[model samples]
Target: MKKRTDQFYLVREDMLSEAMLKTIKAKMLLENGKFNKINEVVKEVDLSRSAFYKYKDGIFPFHTMVKEKIITLSIHLEDRSGALSKLLSLIAQTGANVLTINQTIPLQGRATITLSIETAAMTADVTVLLGKIEELDAVVKVELIGSGA
Candidate 1:
């Protein structure tokens, strides 16, 4: 048997229980400054305090999950002149701050590059950025390797 400690899922809003949905609304109210206290938010959202507390730290909007975090990407590129420079320039255009970059020595005209970037200031969605990267002529593949604070 396997133990599940850290698992994530993407569920439709309609599939959630009323309490869970209310908890989400309550949290949003607090975050948006509409309510100063948890009590106020719970009241506005019609959720019980205990139920709000139960799901507060467990659920988050999708954008909230990825915003203001660092993401690592693994990219396969053709070892051609200026390919790396163009790639970095494209990433810069998205307003993402590059934290670190690692590249393997070119082997058989191909190289793998790993990049860690801060997404807090990004102007584009991560998915959009990945799509743009994939369309680049010299890029063979791009994979979201990991993300963290």
Candidate 2:
């Protein structure tokens, strides 16, 4: 047996500077397909291209790893024929396994769907999967909410 001890650290979200926030926003825009090119992402986020280059590798979201393995995704999708079907098809094509799925009633013109998936056999990297999901016409927004393997 080994002794155990509790450890903790405090972080203040408000203490983050504007540049850090802009860097994170730029990365999110790229992740969400709101901006395709790096220049466009940096420009839209009002950060210089040099700043983007400088901070991008180190400015990933706190939940980025949640997008990499077993993942919980929240999707806002148009309530239309074959929308969910097509989304699932893409996931299958990527060799990801669906662990669970839940959807809310269509409100207005869209529905909120939560899917938990395992990526043990994912055909490519998570970034590729994210790009594919973002390309789906019926998908309005896709967020990585949580993950557990």
Candidate 3:
């Protein structure tokens, strides 16, 4: 097996208050689609209903903030009808709002398209979205040209 360079560090378990632990559990429950109603979440996590309400709006998973940034993608695709349309549809499905799109004329059956997109509402990580784009039959190459908040 290959050595794993990415590892997770654990914080002292005792450092967290019972309320905090419950809140974390409640959030996880919500993310996993195991629970939706606040009452259900509070009960599942063993948290007082009031405590759950107090902290729920203030806490969020790390990826929530990361997804708020805007990024520009440069894609080289096979010059074929519906190729661009399919790519745009994939972006919409990923919840990325397109800010700008520039496509160069086809040359030797390939074209370069650049898209600047707001990722705030994206349901998945940028890498995952890029991977999906790469898997499309019409896409020849994809690159992240830049990103910003």
Q: In model 1, which regions exceed 4 Å deviation?
A: 1-6, 9-64
TM-score of 2: 0.57
Better of 2 and 3 by lDDT: 3
Please list all clashing residue pairs in model 2, or write none if there are none: none
Q: Which ten residues in a row have the lowest lDDT in candidate 1?
A: 60-69
Candidate with top lDDT is 1
The per-residue C-alpha lDDT of model 2 at residue 146 equals: 72
Kindly indicate the candidate among 1 and 3 with the higher lDDT: 1
For every candidate, C-alpha RMSD to the true structure in Å: 4.8, 10.8, 9.7
Q: How do all the candidates rank in terms of lDDT, highest first? A: 1, 3, 2
lDDT of 3 at 111: 96
Better of 1 and 2 by lDDT: 1
Model 3 scores a TM of 0.57
- For model 2, residues 100-127, the per-residue Cα lDDT tens digits are 9999999999999999999878877766
User: Which regions of candidate 3 are displaced past 4 Å?
Assistant: 1-68
Give the alpha carbon lDDT tens digit for every residue of 1-149 in model 3.
96745453334646767887788789888888999888888987789988888767655544443464798999999999999999999999999899999989999999999999999888889878999999999999999877789
